[model samples]
Target: MTSTVVEQLIVPIRRSVTRVFNYSRNVKGLKTHLEELSDAKTRVLHSVDEARNRSEDIEDDVGKWLASVNVITEEATRVFGDEDKANKRCFMGLFPNVTTRYKVSTKIESIAEEAVKISVRGKFDRVSYRPSRRGIEDRSHKHYEAFESRGPVLDEILEALKDDDVDLVGVYGMPGVGKTTLVKKVAGQVKAGKIFDVVVLAVVSQTPNLRKIQGEIADGPGLKLDAETDSGRADFLYERLKREPKVLVILDDIWERLELDDVGIPSGSDHRGCKILMTSRDRNVLSRGMVTKKVFWLQVLPENEAWNLFKKMAGDVVKYPDLQLVAVEVAKRCAGLPILIVTVARALKDGDLSEWKDALERLKRFDKDEMDSQVYSALELSYDSLKGEEIRSAFLLCQQYRVVER
Candidate 1:
């Protein structure tokens, strides 16, 4: 009977010592486990495929799991660092150490169990996820000088942008007719209203540099392209743009139809919710080259609007009763062109009645081609406002140089 009692006591005591020894070794291995956990987390975060599937739930789960692992690893390191002391503390006078070792082993085992569970939960399948969008830079300041006549055109463009079927819209007009200004107003309104998830504006000058154009467009969304070749950059752009649910791309000063595919812009049936707004000097570029869904032709401002704009630029000069009549004639000479009107009006501003008369005479003297007369005559009026012969001669020399260079 005594032997049976001894055996029962001995078996439990032996098992307890073995558990303590095994747990001590496992605690040492916790550092390795922590390293693995950290590496796994970095892999998941940087993986484009994994990022696509990233969600709030997954982020929270990972965060909590990582925090818990760090805590356990730190505690285990401290405990295992003084293993000899822990072993000594386990013993009591004339009694085998069972309670302390048992407690330590259980705590370590509990942490290890949790670590396993987290590892399993952290494993995720790749899925589509939204790319981080760069904030749209506000351009409302440019719209301050927008012409009054552009109100109707701005409204029409805004309405067309809202239509589900119209993915591409074009604004075409003569140089300095406010094509850029009108589009800027539209872009500002769209941004303020949050009409699209992303809005990008790029200038495609007469000669389109594919890479430069791509860089500008990519800048809007904060996309960095590391591709060496033009086609590679386009490919990168295509992939990035594909992930955006709604985007508006504005191409200003386009001389010809840009190859949508070459630029990495999706158009036609594959456009998704993306919309393209462009401005060009030629209507043919919009209708034939770009094959835009709708084209809005921006005409020169009317006589009344031109006069109002001229007065606005001329300031207090137009308020003078005597100068008012001459100012009206100067504004009319601008021929309803905002650029010409603003230039000529500002030149004659604060000038005496005689200066205004001289400007009118110089404008009438220019009998060049119709377009040349319209543009250069107004410019010449501004040039004639110079105070002295030396200044005027220098100005004319510069003008001559400009013509030669052109």
Candidate 2:
């Protein structure tokens, strides 16, 4: 098993190492861009605009390019830094299927003030930016969407559990509407806070496999279940979970209603201190699985909120002065879908209007296809357009399951 883990990792690790090597030259280019931006004055005569354009080309392109690269590297590494199994599973397994959302704990004043510094807007109330807080700009605004975890959403969910009146809590939304993301966000904080004696987060795909799920639930409380039989595994799990004073189990992406007893995982209700949180696309599924608590429904992010979230991950790449109008039209087409926002934004990260227009056309024809592909496509150009294009192309084209990228 350990060897299998190493084998699984070699490919991505090698790919990462190769990326580091292949990008060394490009990294040097970043230094050159920095040198220019460092010296470029903010204010110039109107007549120098065209000449400035000619001179600032290196800095403009390199600044955005390196900034984008840093975005991916830093974001991917932090979210995906688990040492072994979690990292291995997380890179493709955990993160690809899910994006996280927590509450924004920052006050309105700070958010607005920070937006001014970044020169990005934080307000989404109007089609135009309010002039001096009382008027509007035809094409200016203070806010866009992001997939970042926030503090308020986190606190609300954690507190909801504390309310005894709430039972069989459910977070419902369409597939990839961040149902999984919400649960995972909560699970991380809850586990980190040591809020419970045991916390287990498991990905329950469409199959609803009891055997596999039993193994997963039992993974909590440090109990080793080398048991081969389903019943044996269940027995061990029940014993381990029975004594814990506080336990929280997150059953992620539950496709259908399942009897917890049959699966060998106990709902916290039995012990007065346990809680089971779930994510599902179907309300019926949540209702059926309402073992001990009520369900909470999550809607797709509102148009403004969704765009804000997507634009944040997308960073400066999507905010081109050149493609602003066309991109807004394209963003509208996403119909406030978080997955679509992410997928389309990622697909357009290269900042090519022509390519972006082509992708918009593609989305028109195949908008409802796998959200994963759309999201991955957003990063396709940047991650692919670099050198070693053939290697990148080959590795990406391979099937997701059991892919050995090395």
Candidate 3:
């Protein structure tokens, strides 16, 4: 029985001593494991760079594994500092330092195992995924009215776009005449038909914000503008835009002359594949200021088409004979402008006979003035008809900050 107990204890004590004696081998093994981990890390970093170039986000597990590898490698580096002490002789330089060797060897083996585990975990099926596209989706799904009067102008714009020699196209109309709507329709169609590989829009407004305009256009191509100055940003954008083989840029509500190069847009002359579609309230803004190759004027809806749109927005209430005549009179008061027709029709859609007559009276009072006066008057009547003060306040704010012409 005594010999049996001694044998069992001898096995564990001998195993422990064996690990201390194998210190050199464990250190060498640690070095090999660290080298393998380093190679794996390099491959992962390369994949991360490629994924970023493609505008993709890295996976959480991959990021975590990379972080663990960094930690393990750092720990392994510190382990080497104890090598001399672990190899020192003790007892007057006659014997190995068993205690130090045991501690150092155990640490090396533990770190080596950790490094191996991390390297195996680094293998992944996918490193990243494409992020959601911005700005383009919002413009793609915007609401547009297919007015008959605007069809000819839309077709003309499309035809001009198809012409190889005509690179710059402009659409000009009075405020509230659906200039923005028509141009947006063109953008949607071109995007759907793949007329251009890249389509971007910037609202130039009455007061142009060059940086904001640059950002909007850059967002389309997933470009990050990190330049500190306007000129620097422009130069960067210019190079990026030039890389696109086929591109369309829509500058909306341009009030005066804007320098294309200053805005970082490659002119049609500079990049033959680049095309520009712009809109403004003044014809000269397009013809003289922008020097467009072709310009189309968007007219107000005709009287018959105006009536039909009014009927649709006002709903079944217009079908009643009693209200039909009054509705026709109200629709005519809109002067064939799409915005005014829709706004005024919605304001009085569910009103009684007296309310319709009151709106008609208000509209007539402003009729003695020019067409612009009539538009503002119809807008005023719509404002008064709104139920809540908060809604009216929001409308005023929108009008004050309206970026597009209408």
Cα lDDT tens digits, model 2, 287-390, are 76565356666765666776676676556866678777667656756555565566556555665778667655543543446554433333233334433444
Alpha-carbon lDDT, every model: 0.73, 0.53, 0.83
Which candidate achieves the best TM-score against the true structure? 3
The reply for model 3, stretches above 4 Å from the true place, is 1-142, 368-373, 382-385, 388-406
Give candidate 1's error at residue 174 in angstroms: 1.4
The residue ranges of model 2 lying beyond 4 angstroms of the native Cα positions read 1-156, 165-167, 192-194, 289-292, 366-406
TM-score per candidate: 0.61, 0.51, 0.69
Order candidates by TM-score, high to low.
3, 1, 2
Per-residue lDDT, model 2, residue 308, is 78
Extract clashing residue pairs from model 3: none
Evaluated at residue 330, the lDDT of candidate 3 is 83
Residue-level lDDT for 146 in candidate 2: 27
Please give the distance, in angstroms, between residue 84's alpha carbon in candidate 3 and its true position after superposition: 30
For model 3, the local distance difference test gives: 0.83
Residues 147-195, candidate 1: write the lDDT tens digits.
Answer: 6678888899999898998988999986667787778778778877989
